[model samples]
Target: MTDEMNNAQEWQARAESAEAALSRVQAEVDARLIRAELKAEALRAGMVDLDGLKLLDTEDLRLTEAGDVADAPALLARLKRAKPWLFGVAMSSSSAANPPRPEPPRTRHANDLSHEEWLAARAVLLRRR
Candidate 1:
């Protein structure tokens, strides 16, 4: 009877320890899943950088049994709304209010320059040298 009692207690201790370890591992895995979900949603929302995720409040975030975040997309959307600079610039359907300025004209090369123009340019360049 004494031996049996001791054996039962030993088994109980071992089981408790195993349960504790399992819980720790499970929590770690859930945290990783949450992070992955957040990243996926942030990417879909056009986050400029993953670092911006750190700014989000994750205390309200919860994981579903399937390892998916319950409101990751919504959370990301809220974050985007609060911090527009954290995401990629949104394109407009209409053209820019100010049209792009035309590129400056190309510089005329010596070979393309008229004889008189070349002579004038040559004198200027020579003076600079």
Candidate 2:
């Protein structure tokens, strides 16, 4: 029937709209992440030496150019021998930057005192004044 055909077209339109919205949101997220990385890099400059050991991000550890993995073990051995934290700055910065996780939602219990009970408690304090 024509009615069924119209309903199918409407559903298809809605699906296309949803996909477009998702793409826009993903683009925005990518832009934000790029900005954060740039800011972090600027903050790290001058303080670390790129020649001796490539500065990563927050912590001090160098990485080999061949692969993404940090040359942490060699750096750690050096740190153990030097014990440079005594001076204030730790020599190397961490190569990996971790994104923050979203916070969990708060929970409420019905057995907990209702909103009316809170108002009553406030009233009792006002009466004493």
Candidate 3:
């Protein structure tokens, strides 16, 4: 009877140890998740525009290889002072507005042309406008 009680006590101690280890692991995971959530919230709050295309620093203005004005805020401020129309385009394409969608292909009548002809027609259509 004493031996059985000792074995049961040993098992209970092992179970408690495992539970404590699991709790420690869970706490670490929870902390990491909380940090990640906070970072995401900070980014969202600090976001000046949607695509993150505009930088927080405005003084660094230059044209990128992709032709986008690099120092967007300064460029925007300049445009606001100079050309409102150009500024509007920049603002519309920035994170503050939904991105411009590519224009859909113009459809041609299937009955008027064969498949190969339609493909060739589409290529010509795409090039023309």
Candidate 4:
């Protein structure tokens, strides 16, 4: 009976140890996944350095997790407000994916005048004649 009790206690201890180890692994995995998500968001917002992006506070973490982050500009602005040091350097943003087509150059000649202007000028010339 005594041996059986000791064996049961040992089994219980091992089980508790395993449970603790599993919980730790789970926490680590969750933390990594959160970092990955934030990194992805940062990259989408044109942030170059994944290392530079750190979840600021519990509210920030919750906001990211809840998918309540703002658009790219607002997100960048919020991050700048939170971590001004991170934005201290001049980070280069990519040019718009497709820049608007350049307007075609005007084809009108330098002396080109509107119809009204031309008519008025002709009237003045006739008066001079």
TM-score of each: 0.70, 0.36, 0.36, 0.49
TM-score of candidate 3 relative to the true fold = 0.36
Candidate 3: where is the Cα deviation over 4 Å? Answer: 47-129
Off by over 4 Å in 2: 47-129
Q: Pick the candidate with the highest lDDT.
A: 1
Candidate 2 residue-wise lDDT, 15-47, digit = tens: 999999999997666555544443344334322
The CA lDDT at 47 in model 3 is: 38
What local distance difference test score does each model get? 0.89, 0.52, 0.55, 0.65
Worst 10-residue lDDT window, candidate 4: 55-64
- Tell me which of candidates 1 and 2 scores higher on lDDT: 1
| lDDT of model number 3 | 0.55
Given candidate 2, what's the lDDT at residue 20?
A: 100
- Cα lDDT of candidate 4 equals 0.65
Give lDDT tens digits, candidate 1, residues 31-115: 7888889999999999989999999877677898787899788888888889999999987889558876899987877889899
Cα error, candidate 1, residue 73 (Å) = 1.5
Summing lDDT over every window of 10 consecutive residues in candidate 1, give the lowest-scoring window.
91-100
TM-score of 2: 0.36
Instruction: Please give the distance, in angstroms, between residue 82's alpha carbon in candidate 4 and its true position after superposition.
Output: 4.6
